[model samples]
Target: MNSRAAQLQAFDRLLTIMDELREQCPWDKKQTMQTLRHLTIEETYELGDAILDNDLEEIKKELGDVLLHIVFYAKIGSEAKSFDIADVANEICKKLIHRHPHIYGDVKVKDEADVKRNWENIKLREGKKSVLEGVPKSLPALVKANRIQEKVAGVGFDWEEPHQVFEKLREELAEFQQEVKSNHKERMEAEFGDVLFSMINYARFLDINPENALERTNKKFMERFQYVERKAKDIGKSLQEMTLAEMDVFWEEAKTMDKRF
Candidate 1:
């Protein structure tokens, strides 16, 4: 690991490189925040994938990509005479110190939950109309649902026990089943969303990240299916030409090859 001085020096190097790129690179000079927004989002998702895979080298590279985007945006801001990198960094630093009153001030906190409650209260005191205001409108539905639940829970709007959440999930499931039986497409969609929201809440109560769990299942399914595809090809058959039993054999084989399943 680098020393503090070394880390600062490396960051300074990055800033210098960014300045040069903005001056000399036509593409960089032509870019605006609006034009870079989608690319930044793609880089963020790449970083997320690296983290999920637990690939340290890939994670380090992705972090650099994200950091470059930050610096790029800061450079643009400086050009517009709005705010520079220092202003952006200092603002977050101030916000952090303000939020963590237990550390920066004499505020008392008994546990993680107390800290969370205090954080929400501080946001409200800071003129936030609602705790939910912190959640971004552009976040994916699953992530947005989780953030909404967490924000409300931070302010004491939550079930008291895991069993209560489980019961709520069961109730949602029953409602969804009723909607399914009625075969009302719109009602079923609404009920199904409620079921998913309830399930995410239940997952939270169980100390699980519903997004990560679902993503892991998705990755596992893709790997197993790909294995089945490979096996079918090796047997001189396409997937459409293979019987269900034949594919199931390869799927089981893939499962046995990896203990994670």
Candidate 2:
């Protein structure tokens, strides 16, 4: 069979297995959307980690896990006579087609930036009261900041240049320093938030995703830390017993070895 047909057949098999599990597996039958919410979030992070690690096999497996969650949710909805898998697929298909007017319609887009601008304009035209309305409240703070900036920038509200964003970041940092010196707890917290927000804006100005940047740092730290642990074990010293100087040596070595970053 052709690739598309093979994919469809695989999807059909997954759906069939889901149906059997719902009917015959006690654990699967007992799952509710509320219970699965955290699992879905965890699966998403696993997929992200896989992507960041460049582990295609892990990414494929994690994607299947996420897809199973989607199908499971659809199955639950079907049981309740709310909606089915086809409805879920149709909704996203319609959304994709609607959003890509430049692809499916005669809308002219000069570049990726223009496409983003058009997307925001189309979303506004779709009756959304605010550009920020679609941002999930549960999103990580850095990601939320990035999304908020992008949404506003879509409508022409943004810094003219990266230097302008950098200046703002510096200003916020100065204010945060002042708050720290004054020991005003509440004001310090607010200023700290402003500093982070400005940093996120600077990240956006440079066409960098703050969340992905942070995640990459997180992974790098974990890898270096594991190296430290392994080195300490090899030398017959526990991590807790290792000196700061010794750990720093291993950390610097890790930084040198991790040339890809």
Q: In model 2, what lDDT does residue 51 have?
A: 92
Model 2 pairs whose backbones collide: none
Let me know the TM-score candidate 2 reaches against the reference structure: 0.93
Q: How many residue pairs clash (N, CA or C atoms closer than 3 angstroms) in each of the candidate models, in the order given?
A: 0, 0
Each prediction's whole-model lDDT (CA): 0.96, 0.92
- On lDDT, the candidate that comes out on top is 1
| Residue-wise C-alpha lDDT for candidate 1, range 45-149, written one tens digit per residue | 999999999999999999999999999999999999999999999999999999999999999999999999999999999999999999999999999999999
- Scored by TM-score, the top model is 1
Worst 10 residues of 1 by lDDT: 252-261
- Candidate 2, residues 1-261: lDDT per residue as tens digits? 369989999999999999999999999999999999999999998998899889999998999999999999999999999999999999999998999998998888888889888888889899998889989999988888889999999888888989988999999999999999999999999999999999899988887888889988988899899998988988999989978999999989888889866
Model 1 superposed RMSD (Cα): 1.0
* Runs with alpha carbons beyond 4 Å of true place in candidate 2: 259-261
